[model samples]
Target: MLAIAEYVVRGALSGAIYALLAVPMSLMFVTVRTIDFAVGAYALIAAAVCWSVGGALGLAAGLGAAMACAAFMAIIFLALKRLGCEDHIIYALASFGLATALASLVLWWWGTQAFVRDAFSDPWSVGGIRLAPQGVINFALILLLVGALHLLIQHTSLGRMMRAAAANQTGAALASIPVQGIQVGTYLAGGLLGGLAGLLVLYSAGLDFTAPLGLTLSGFGAAIIFGIGSPLRGFFGGLAMGIAQALAAGYASAMVAGMVPFLFVLLVLTTSRFGEEALAGGRP
Candidate 1:
């Protein structure tokens, strides 16, 4: 029973990290109807910067790099919007190209070597289960993010405007809400969050160029499993995925754990007719 409990706790922590990574992607999908393939790349950039610089300066540099990447994405996407490229496919292609470019850049600059953050030399432990300080930090940040999102969505005018724009872009614009500004703001915030997730990932597992694709896939799987429209649902979905993977790795094999996300993605795709209909404000 204790072993089971340990696995459950470990899985939940992993899920929290997955949820954190998924939130930014989910937010962007709902708000701007754009899938940012570069989201994971943004995280990679932050982590690489953090590793190169170290300490507080590294942290700030990492965040700044993420913000800059976000700004660049916003500029390109907003330009696409202005240039009559309204199709989501175009935006997706643009994001994919940007992500590829960024990955190449990071590879050239940072090399393909992997490194972990090692935040705590002595991680906290209880009942034979060890917990990294970085994991605790990740959980705390997830809670803070969820709380802030809830407050923004429930208690603020900006939240209302965001909802309005998400529900019906034309109606929101007709209502005179700053729809474009809201989307731009969402992109910026998503970028920042994406960067933070990257830092957390670095702390937990280290990173290489390949990390971006895995992170991106995991984020999408989590968000899609719960229907991307709801951040809270996505969070829980991520938690579930993490738990399953942990259990698989603990009882089965590490190879199985690595494949769990792909399996989950396929399960959702084959089982649900929705296929991310939540993006259209529909529930999964």
Candidate 2:
């Protein structure tokens, strides 16, 4: 019983991180109708740059570096759009190229290795249960950010405009919404969220060159399960997916645990429920 509770806490911590990582993709897809296959690479580069900058300056400075990386990503997305091409799959392919280039850049600069963040601190223990302080902090911060983003989307005129643009770009243009600026914002938001996740991952785990791609896949799976294509359900959708993964890892065998996320997604697709209630996170 106590073991179950302990594992639950652990799951929540990790699940929150995954949720945070998933939000940007969800928001962007919901708002812009574009997919970024390289979302994970954007994060990887952010982590590397953060580590590099943090090494020289401080945590704040490292964050700046991550933001700068995201800013660069913003440029790439817009540049491609301006080139008269914005197909989801096509843009995602270009993102792949950037991912490869980023990976190479990381190898050139940092080599294939991990980093250590001293202030990240150790996990805290209570009532015979252990918890990571950094993990808790990350979780809380994400909640705040996600909540704010959701509120902004749901309540603000800008959010309405975004939804309008996402649904019908041409119609929205006829309606006089700045479709291009909104698109850029969507990509920028995606990049920033991904970059932040990358930095958090580094703080949580050591860095590796190939890890970003894997993390991107992980985030992508969770987003799909959560119906990220629809904004209203994104938060709990991502949360539920993260929690499902957490539970699988905690209770199942290593191999099965490794397969749980993907397997669950496949299961979701098999059922009609996934197609229905997309507004609530399930997808069609």
Candidate 3:
């Protein structure tokens, strides 16, 4: 039971980090029906900067640097939007190009070496279970993000507009909602969150150039399971997924690590669908 609790905590922390990366895609998909692939790209780039700056500035400064990166992604993506092409495939390809360019730039600036951010020398632990202060910080950020998102969606006119826009862009336009602005704003927010997730990972596990995209894929898997295709569903769903993942990893056969999460994701998706189908059949 003690070991189980530790694994659960570990999963939740890691999940929150990757799930943060997942939310932007879910939110963007809700509104624009497509992902800004640049989310992970910009995050990876920002993390590299964070590592470079870790020598003099520290974690807080590193996060600011990460946010700046997202801001740059927003500006460039919007500028591209002004050129008048929103084709899904085109947008994805363009985002890929942007991500590739940014990664290259980071490589040139930061020499592809890995960085491990040791925030706490004495992590809190109990009975063979260890907890990082940074993990608490990660959980807090996730909660704050969820609270803010909930407040925005429920209390603001702009929030209403965005919800409407997500449901139907044409209708939203007819209702005078600025869909383009919403889209760009989503991109900006998503990029910021993505960068933060990357920073958290650096704070915990360190990073390599090849690691960013892989992390993004992990987040993507979580997003799919968390029902991140919708922002509102993102918060709770991501939490569940993170917890599930941690458990799988804790007891998983050491020889089969790479397959564990994938199997878990497949299981979750299958179960969700099966449950829904059973519910539908029982509705009679």
- Give each model's whole-structure lDDT: 0.81, 0.69, 0.69
TM-score, every prediction: 0.92, 0.87, 0.84
lDDT of 1 by residue, 13-76 (tens): 8888778778877777767876787888888999999889999999899999988998898899
For residues 28-129, write the lDDT of model 3, one tens digit per residue.
665666666766765676667777776546555656665666666667667767787667667666666776776777777777788667878888875687
Worst 10 residues of 2 by lDDT: 275-284
Using lDDT as the yardstick, the better of models 1 and 3 is 1
**TM-score comparison, 1 vs 3, better candidate:** 1
lDDT per residue, candidate 2, 80-123, as tens digits? 77787767767667767777777787788889787556554566
Q: Global CA lDDT of candidate 1, please?
A: 0.81
Clashes of 3: 0
Candidate 1: segments with Cα more than 4 A from true spot: 253-257, 268-284
- Model 3 residue 113 CA deviation in Å: 0.7
Separate clash counts for every candidate? 0, 2, 0
Error at 120, model 1, angstroms? 0.6
